[model samples]
Target: MSEKLRVGFIGAGLMGHGMAKNLVERGFPLTVMGNRNRQPIDHLVSLGATEAKTARAVAEASDIVFLCLPNSAVVDKVVLGPDGIAEGAHDGLIVADSTTADPTETKRIGAALAEKGVAMLDTPLTMTPKEAEAGTLNVLVGGLAEVLERARPAIACFGRNIFHVGPLGAAHSLKLINNFMSMSMVALFSEAVVTARKAGVSVDGLHELISAGALNNPLFQKVMDWPLKGDASGLQFAIENALKDVSYYNRVAADAGATAPIGATVQQIYALANAQGEGKTHVPKLMDVLGRLNGL
Candidate 1:
């Protein structure tokens, strides 16, 4: 453990904070940057992580840098921007990008990093910050076998399940598809809940009936937590993030010459929610938004 590779983290938001803490707890000499969220960065600093001033500083201090940003745009800005990771990166530095970003952008970035002898691994994550804090997240990785091996030890500190999906950008593709499916469920179930109320079916009854049948799933339980228990804490993901993922998914589908009519409709549902100013709300509260729309 004394010879462990040094690690750097660029985002300290909900999920990033938890993962950064796990790295420190697992004995990685860690560096972190204060993003829009400061609490997690401060907390991590208290627990022995060096607080860097910029992404470049973070890269300069570590063997591998993890980017858990909002999307490809932000990720690109932080990684390739002035004083970004690319500026401070040395040859052989590995970047494990955990942001749910565009696969095309990932391939492009990976190519850019290649010239500097920097390796980019698309290591998008699943599950929640709850699992992140517990060091039990499922990490989908896309990179060469050797690179994944290099990242595995540190990733295992916070990731319970690590799947080396394919080459660069594959993990991001899978993540976007996964989010498309899950976010669509959140939207579908939210509508069903609203319809149940309008049609005189109690929310509890609907939940119980579904729980008794095959329709039950972890996603359902999380989404229904709001309508059934007045808690959206079960799913901490924001609606804005959901919209971004699904939009990314749409790009993935279109690139493959596929028609995602259902995905298109689902995207509109989230787009309306975002336009209605529910972007900052958690996914579960979509029930409330749809309810108000239907006069429920």
Candidate 2:
């Protein structure tokens, strides 16, 4: 709180905008790179955050750069490609990523950044974008203790429950696992809903019974939001993203010599939804997707 760090942010998408907004409101000097979307970029600039032409420019003006991009490929390109953050890397600079990404890729990127004296932390996040906008996303930090301590102040501006998991890549590994479980729950609830309807049981009855039983979960309520209340705002994740994370979990498990039968099945389910052209549809709408599948 005493000394505000200069912060640079890339990927001003769903989760990034809120995280970047909090950084500026919390008083860190902010520099931001423009992404495909201009609304969040303009909004951040309107709040007194400086806009940079490229990731390199953002990095040049920052002591710490945070990336909240969608995937590993884009994150890698922004940090390591032409006119990217690597071009502007300096000694003692730090980069933290909140993208749900591959652990192997995260480690490789961190190692590459280390050679340039830029410490990297994989700080994958939990909670929704609503929570992100509220500055309360739970931060699963994966990096050196000393580096995290140095970067804690700025991270504290947006995180609620921040905890160190391990060295670089650990947080990402955990994130993939966490996402897989949550997305699988979405699929499970969707099937249960359709099955309830097909068997002459109302979704309302199913929801009421589950609400009082061990099958109840926050996600169960969210998925039920669609059938019971026609509200998809409860879980805003895209079906495409669900497939991505589930597939990533399977790959991570294979790399570790572990089998993931559940992850494999979940991957195919989301793939089916995506093939049905519901890729961009949010998770709560999975109820509809499965409902149609069951002819209900």
Candidate 3:
């Protein structure tokens, strides 16, 4: 029988914790790196997963290293900086980055890793931390088909809906495009809500009209309902992260020489929210940010 792969996980925060837990529970020999918060690292350690001192250590101790960080900048720093994955990576080692990153950076990192005989795959994730916990997150992969097949089992531990989008940086590019549309919708929705409220329209009435129409979607429901219930925690994604993704999207559009007026507009709105100290708030709370901006 073939042996299970040795898996190392970096970034044991909201989304990473559940993903790491499933890898360990699925019989993989898992090693998790320490993060700012000890609770997740301690919890993973208690589940028979070993803890590593640094990203390099985690990479050295495992066959497949999974990164679930915030943005491209952090991903770049962790994989290419001092004491990073590149330092400890060996020939034939696979690095799967699950962060929504810049496609250009992903390509550059993939090239660097390739020179060292380390294969880098862009495997950006969809869904939320809730789905991450349930082991049903959606994974969009971009790399060699054979490499994806090899990593499929471990990825399946946390992802139920997985798609091999294309080669190298395609998945990250698609992720940016996807996030642009989603965030744009949320921004437009928030603006509509704030405008309606100013005109003395009921928020619940607006929700009812939209919910009963073809415009309703799972994302719309999630962004609206959670906030209405006074629990924006259901989304599990921060406003700053949303801004980061939209900014990445704008960059992608600019590089492609395509005009992205709406994307640019959404980016500005998120920037405003972040400037108002709502960076750490959940994405759904953009409603509150917009409301406050309008003096509501």
Residues 69-166, candidate 2, lDDT per residue (tens digit)? 88899889999999999999998899999999999999999999999999999999999999889999899999999999989998988899899999
Give the CA lDDT, 0 to 100, for residue 286 in model 2.
79
The window of 10 residues in a row where model 3 has the poorest summed lDDT is 225-234
lDDT computed for candidate 1: 0.92
From the highest TM-score down, the ranking of the candidates is 2, 1, 3
lDDT of candidate 1 over 1-296, digit per residue (tens): 34899999987788988899999988899999886667898899999999899999999999999999888998888888899898998977999999999999999988988888899899999999899999999999999999998888999999999999999999999999999999999998999999999999888999999999999999999888898779999998889989999999999999999999989998999999999998999999998989899987
Measured against the true structure, the TM-scores of the candidates, in listed sequence, are 0.97, 0.98, 0.96
The reply for model 1, stretches above 4 Å from the true place, is none
Each candidate: what lDDT? 0.92, 0.91, 0.90
When 1 and 2 are scored with TM-score, the better candidate is: 2
Quality of model 3 by C-alpha lDDT = 0.90
Error of 3 at 73 (Å): 1.8
Error in Å for residue 70 of model 2 = 1.0
